[model samples]
Target: ARRVVATLSIGKRSHFATARVAMEAYAKRVGAEFVVVDSTAHASLARWNATLHSGSNSHFMKLPMLQWFLEHYDQLLFLDDDVLVSPFAPDLFSSVPCEAFGAVYEGYHKQGWHSMHARSFCSLYGLA
Candidate 1:
């Protein structure tokens, strides 16, 4: 299966630069292609910046990036530029089923959904 590890890097500088070396090594270990989308010059960025009040520009950019990746890849592992993967981490592609979407739900706790962040995220995608 075609698999890719992708991240979006926007703004004046590349946030992915610091973690690129390590992330590329991890992607190689996991047998996936590594890609970075530098969208600082994208036309949609200015519009998104002006209109979006709920999420940051980078977060909104992920929606289109995800759509593009899904069209070209059988599986994709989308990580924030700031995330560094451990060399010893397992191959996540093998763990998830082909037809299902996988994500780490950090907004939930023992008391149930506890933050506005989670609610806003769900509402953003109409999952609420």
Candidate 2:
């Protein structure tokens, strides 16, 4: 057995079934369970607001992974739709070991297109 089980959250049932099926097929080949956390745009977003406000506005529509985050996931990953996973995913979860962690991305934006607005309109000049 290569892995125990890899868990990830899904915004909806049919959002990425094709890719999910491919992943499920691979995981089955290696004896693993792919847990899909069914989530929503409304409920999850509301929860995100309740838990965190202010800077949360920066991320816009994408549902933050905290809603469907599975604590048991040894190396819990907050993923988005555009991710590409290869069949040879060896050492996928070898390095991470922390209560909370995220890579320091060097200028990358992954979401809908929107124009940058004037900070004078936003509180704290949105320096947050």
For candidate 1, write residues 14-127 as lDDT tens digits.
435546766797789989999877664454244455446655545565676577778779999988876656556799999996678999855535664434444553464354
Give every collision pair in model 2.
none
For each candidate in turn, the TM-score is: 0.64, 0.41
Give model 2's clash tally: 0
- Global fold similarity of model 2 (TM-score): 0.41
Global Cα lDDT for candidate 1: 0.70
Q: What's every prediction's RMSD, in angstroms?
A: 11.5, 13.6
lDDT for position 42 in model 1: 51
| Stretches > 4 Å off in candidate 1 | 13-15, 40-59, 107-128
How high is the lDDT of residue 29 in model 1?
A: 90
lDDT value, residue 127 of candidate 2: 27
Query: What shift in Å separates residue 76 of candidate 2 from its native position after superposition?
Result: 0.6
